[model samples]
Target: MKIGRIETFYVPPRWLFVRVESDDGAVGWGEASLEGHAEAVDGAFEALRDRFIGHDPRRIEDIWQVSYRGGFYRGGPVLMSALAGLEQSLWDLKGKVVGLPAWEMLGGRVRDKIRAYAWIGGDRPSEIADAAKVRRDQGFSAVKMNATAELDWIGTPRLFDEVVKRVEAAQATGMDVGLDFHGRVHRPMAKQLAKVLEPLGLLFIEEPLLSENPDGLRQIAELTSTPIALGERLFSRWDFKPFFEMGAVDIIQPDLSHAGGILECRKIAAMAETYDIAVAPHCPLGPLALASCLQLAACTPNVAIQEMSLGIHYNVGHDLLEFCSDQQVLTPEDGYLRIPQGPGLGITIDEDAVREAHKERHRWRNPVWRHSDGSFAEW
Candidate 1:
């Protein structure tokens, strides 16, 4: 069927959803939320619609190639994220027409359920022990928290004692803790923090330094045994190749929405598998984004754990399940989400809720943080 129309919705708490329709009345949905840059990603769709309106919706790979190669300047967050949503919706539409789930078409099921981890402490972590206890009571065995609020270039060793104490408190609740540096730490402090936190037995340390600093990452990886998890920012397999080649990263956390969609990440995961690196798709958006992540986890063997945004700080008025019609598809049971078996992405959206929410279109932006001296800091 020919692609008849493409529609987009700006849902609350910062999410962008795409709906694709075929000439003969087939429909599919996907998320292209780039968090703070939703407008840029939405603007990207103008070019996509101009290129692929009358094209065959079933030829997903062909569409993807044309979308990428046809555009001379491509492969940034905005372009790739827009293509990711379109590609995901094409797969969803094809799967629905054929009466099969996205995973079955990819390969087959590798596991019945994939373990899920949720966010506990807020950006500037506090009361982590109690937060960990709450997550434990909710049946989550693991939780991720920010390592520090906003760090300067170089801090004293005493700056890390509180960080260590927070992790220890979380661990005391019988939970695995993943400390997220959030790319806020500079290389100097990242090295020191990695060294100090190595003894805590953390599940992983995310973005020890931003992926842009590969040399710094390699240095930090050599200094500590803690797994260096990154790639929430890197948008393509080409972007992730250097880390794999350098043996700098132990775990790759590609966000399905950000890193070119489901199939691209599957390829990236396969590349990581050759390096013996684990996969943990980064997903902190809404339901559609989480469903896309689940589809990837269902077929990919290297995926270690899934990062979900159930009660994350971003979802202020709207939570994960608020717009989801079939909540079971995205809900965690005992810290793991079952592989969705229904057609396409396997989760249904509440169209009414989405349409209503779109009317109010949230202009969500991440907070900008500055150090005590008025210099810019990564937030």
Candidate 2:
């Protein structure tokens, strides 16, 4: 069947969902939420619709290639995210028609279940520990939090002490804690923080200096034993190649929605596999994005842990499984998300809720932070 209609909805709490319908009445759904840029992502689908409206729905890779290369500009958050949603929907549509899950189509099941981690507030030490305890009560064994809110070039000795204290409190709750530097820490402080936090048994330190600072990342990797995880900003396999070659990273956290679609991440995971590195698909978006990660986790053996957006600070009024009709499908059980066996992405979308939410289109943007001296600070 050929692609008939491609629709995009701007759901509440900063998420962009795509619904693809084929001429033969087949349907599939995917999420392309590039938080803070939902409107831009929605605008991106105009070109995709113009290019692939009458194209064969089964030609997944062909559509992906044309979408990426056809536009010589290529690879960025906006373009890749838009293509990622379209590509994921295509996989979902094809799997539904074939009566098998997307993972089965890729290869087969490599693992029965993948571990999941939730986000917690890390700006305050005591509060974060409380948040971690709450997550532990919710059946999560691991939780990730920002290392600091908005760090300057260098921090005080007290700042370091607070970081250690927060992690210690979380660990006391019998939860594995991963500190996200969030690209807010500059190079000078990144190395120092990494060295200090090295003693704690952290799951990983995400975005130690952002993916753009490969040289800085290599330096941080040399200074500490903590698994340096990154790649949420990098959009394609090409962007991931340098990190693998340099051996600057221990685990790669590619966002399924940001780094091309499912198959592209599978390829990236395979590349990381050769380097003996682990894959932890970075997903802090909607159910469709998490489902895409699960599909990747099912077939790719290197995926170590998955990130879910349940109870994350971003989901103010709406939560991760809110728009999903089958909430239990992606729910975490004992800190691990079971591999889905149903067709397509193995999660159902509440289209009516999505349509209604789209009525007051969300204009979500990340907060901009500045240092005490009025200079811009990464947030």
Query: What would the per-residue lDDT of candidate 2 be over residues 1-379, giving only the tens digit for each residue?
Result: 7999999999889889999999999999998989999988899999999999999999999999999999889999999999999989989999999999999999999899999999888566678788988888877999998888756787888889888998988898889999998898999998888989999989999998978789999999999999999989989999999999999999999998888899999999999999999998899899999999999999998999999988646587788888888888888889899999899999888889999999999999997887778888676
Clashes of 1: 0
Model 2 TM-score, 2 decimals: 0.98
Q: In candidate 1, which residue pairs clash?
A: none
Native-vs-model 1 lDDT? Answer: 0.89
Deviation in Å, model 1, residue 293 alpha carbon: 0.7
Candidate 1 residue-wise lDDT, 1-379, digit = tens: 7999999999989999999999999999999999899999999999999999999998988998899889899898999999888888888888899999999999989999999888877432358888887777766899999998756688887789888888888888788999999888999888889989989999999998988899999999999999999999999999999999999999999988888899999999999999999999999888888888889999999999998888645487678889888887887788898889989998888989999999988899988978788888787
| Model 2 lDDT-worst window of ten | 309-318
- Candidate models: Cα lDDT each: 0.89, 0.91
